[model samples]
Target: MERIVLPGDVVWEREVFASGTWVKDGITYAKVPGMLRDEKFIPLEMAYRPKVGDNVVGIVVDERNAGYMVDLNLPYNGVIPTRKVRISLRLGGMVYGKIAFVDEVGNVDIGEVDKLPAGKLITVPASKVPRIIGKKSSMLNQIRDISGSSVFVGNNGYIWIGQKGNMQLVMKALDLIIRRAHTTGLTDQVAKYLDENR
Candidate 1:
């Protein structure tokens, strides 16, 4: 059973894991209402916040004299300076890059980037990205091997499926993974789904 805690509720009197909690005068309180599981507070609602070193898939939406504005599938757009890019990208082009910095005001800066070929892009809840990749990338590898497609999963929840084999199947499998992410025994469930659909 999980324990539900409200905002400002004391989670621990001393030090604990820093996620989802704030410290005040040596006592840690819940920053958000959430379920306490495994000594971690799992918030009922969570949104993706860009962090440095996270790889992301972005679409070039607008070009500026100094850089390109990229849609990172997040609330804030990321800017990739022209000097940092090796290949020239046009509007609507896709690129894979790492977030280099996020300012205090939430503006994002993208680092070195590689332009990607035309492909289908899908968006899933950012929190479910780990489940899609699975342990040691087991789930992602399985999808690639079975579908014969190059799949790029961005930490920001944007997934790019290269145009290769069984695009529809790969999309379906990804959707299943996203939908069943919270359920236990999900890997087995995905395998069964693939078998039945293939």
Candidate 2:
């Protein structure tokens, strides 16, 4: 059952947890304005919160003696320990990795990182990522096919576009997704847009 949920509204009574909701005892409650679909709450707007296993695209904003500080397009910066990487990262380099841990105070630890070559990076709202990726990477694959780029998406909202694609079309499709995400038949619309514009 899907419906518009507001802050503090009880989403479900069972012992389940999902994004944009809080669980107390066995009941799950909404933490923001969003739609509840398939027992998962998707907020209309949100900031990226570090979660274990979420892939991230970040910049090396600063470096410490032990590691580097990464700006993950989140309110808090992430730390990439030197032990996790095989090479030295420059102060302004890009790294792609998954979150290893989020401490109690919101400190993020990144792991399994690889440095990405410099290219175009697009940042969007975290709430829009699910729509951009679509179900089972459908929209993403479409974008990749349309543009001919090996696009990599970070759940935190940083989109990496490779050098070989129709970058303009990719950006346009992403904009179209943000504009029409809540509408039905969005996938169809994207396909049409791509077909007509190409």
Candidate 3:
């Protein structure tokens, strides 16, 4: 017989399964082929639900109300208030936050997490932040202009870049800028090279 599950249960094979499947505390669930039941449930409690105003990590699944709809890894989706965020967020924006409110209608609100000493979100540690800004912000500017992405560098070396529609190139450029920042006049050299090569 297939096992059963309740809400607030996490999927054991998180990387290999779909979201929103039912789970019970301390139990795992799997969909099995043609049996009395399709769900193979196991006891697992790793998945938990977020209470009202509790912070959590979520991905921006949809944008609305000048904010965003985030799948809080819970049974319900949460709203990250635009006011709670200081930047323009697009689909798939990764955010860490606390729950701000859970309305009677099942809508949840999320408040953005604080910026760490590195000046960007806490996810970017201070030690590696400098690599993104480059010396004197030159490489940073190049990334903004070339990728049409808005780049911000915090005084403490935290870097924030905003872009839409597949930002792999922008990400690569930012990484390169930060990694090569220490080279003498690397920004200027790149500028001159781009001018001549193009």
- Report RMSD (Å) for each prediction in the order shown: 2.4, 2.3, 15.5
Using lDDT, give the best candidate's number: 2
TM-score of 3: 0.33
The lDDT per prediction is 0.85, 0.86, 0.50
The local distance difference test score of model 1 is 0.85
For residues 1-198, what per-residue lDDT tens digits would candidate 2 score against the true structure? Answer: 668899989988886677778899888888878887776677887667778999899999998877899999887789998876656888988888999989988899899998888778999888888889989999999989987877888999998888786989999999999987767688889999999987
TM-scores of the models, in the given order? 0.85, 0.86, 0.33
For residue 28, give model 3's deviation from the true position in Å: 25
lDDT tens per residue, model 3, 1-198 = 343444543445343333334344535444321111344333222234345654354566897767777765456677767775665665766565666677776577776554222112222323334445556765666756666655554322224545442245555554544455434466676566444433
Residue-pair clashes per prediction, in order, are 0, 0, 13
Task: Please tell me which model should have the higher TM-score, number 1 or number 3.
Answer: 1
Clashes of 1: 0
**Residue lDDT tens for model 1, 10-67:** 9888867666688878898887666676776666435788989998999999988889
Candidate order by TM-score, decreasing, is: 2, 1, 3
User: Judged by lDDT relative to the true structure, which candidate is superior, 1 or 3?
Assistant: 1
